[model samples]
Each structure stands twice: as C-alpha cells, then as structure tokens.
Target: MKTPVVALLTDFGTRDWYVGSIRGVILVRCPRAQLLDITHEVPPQDVVAGAFTLAGAAPWFPRGTVFVAVVDPGVGSDRSLLAARADGRYFVGPDNGLLALALANAKRYAAVRLTNRR
Candidate 1:
C-alpha cells in the first residue's frame, strides 16, 4: 500500500507542545504515515482565516492526502466533527466552516458528521 500523507493545519502556534502532541498521536496510530505541517499560524480561533488558508493550500497537495484542521472556537460544544472527501483528498476537522471553502471548490465531494468518539 502507498504510504498515507497526513497534513495538519491549526491555530496552535509552534511555541508550545500542541503541535508535537498532535504529531505524536498520529505517529502512535499510524507509524508509516507521512505527516506534513500546512501551518500552525492561523490567528487564534479565526475560522475564516483557517478556511481561506486551507482552501488555498489544498490544491497543491497530491491526491489522497488527508488534512486535519483544528481552528474551532467552539470546541467541546455541540458543533459536529466532520470527515470530508473533496477533490480526491480527505479532510478531518471541526464543522465550524473551516473546511467550507475547500469543499466548495471541489467538483465532487462528500462529508459526514463524525459521531464516534472511540
């Protein structure tokens, strides 16, 4: 099987351990996955900026790349988590419009609310 590419985007800056923690979780779960950092510099809780940045960067990546964006200000609330496939790539993120622009540009796409926490 081809090695999976997982890209991460977040408002969590590099000065702290958040980025490392996220990377550690991914590595623990999928040791062979190739991880890329899109950017962790989106303004804090700025969903629109996150959306714009993600849309801009999504096209440059290869098909089958998975993007994980974490820019939600509504974390731990009722907002849904989403897993979406758009333009042949995958996106996993909060359903707070951060993934909207990217999904909009896709010729074909599908999204689902992720209810399974385990």
Candidate 2:
C-alpha cells in the first residue's frame, strides 16, 4: 500500500507559526504520512482564492490525498467545519463555500457537516 499524503493550503504565510503548528499536529497523528504544501501564501481571508488554487491542482495529485485548506475570516464564529471527498481526494476546511468550486469537479463526491468541535 502507498503512504498517505496530506497537502496543506492556507493563508497563513510562512512568517507565522500557524502552518507549523498544523503540520506538527498532523505529524504527531500520522508520522509516516507524506506532507505537501499546496501554498501557504494565499491572501488572508480569501476563501475564493484558496478554493480555486486547490481545485486547479487537486486532480494531479495521487488519489486518496487529503487536503487541509484554511482561508477563514470567520474562524471564531459559528462557522462549521467540513469534510468532503471528491474525485478520490479528501478535503477538510470551513463550510463557507471554500470547498464548493473544488468539489464541483468531482466525479464522485460526498460531504458531511461535521459536528465535532475540535
């Protein structure tokens, strides 16, 4: 079996610890997982940009790749987190339409409104 890959796309520029913190947590949970950066330079709070970026690049990655995308302006609000599987790739991010464009390309897609607050 192939090792799983988790790609990260965030507006959290490289100057901060946000990306590092997320990477650390993923590493702790799945040390053997391969990590890839979609981009950390997305304009802050620009979910549209983040969504398009992921959609454009998602198809080229291996199937079963997981993408963690964050361009949230409503981070502290009651905005829900989303988990979506589309075109054989997995996505986790906010539910503010950030995943819509990407999920649109999926030949087979499914999403669930996550109730987990973590």
- What TM-score would each prediction reach against the true structure? 0.97, 0.95
Q: What is the C-alpha lDDT of each candidate?
A: 0.96, 0.92
Summarize candidate 1's per-residue lDDT along 1-118 as a digit string, tens digits.
8999999999999999999999999999999999999999999999999999999999999999999999999876888899999989999999899999999999999999999976
What range of 10 consecutive residues in model 1 has the weakest lDDT sum? 72-81
Query: Which residue pairs overlap in candidate 2's backbone?
Result: none
- Predicted structure 1: lDDT: 0.96
lDDT of 2 by residue, 25-114 (tens): 999999988999999999989988998998998999998999998999998789999999998899999999888999998888999989
Off by over 4 Å in 2: none
To one decimal, what is the Cα RMSD in angstroms of model 2 from the true structure? 1.0
Worst 10 residues of 2 by lDDT: 69-78
TM-score of 1: 0.97
Clashing pairs in 1: none
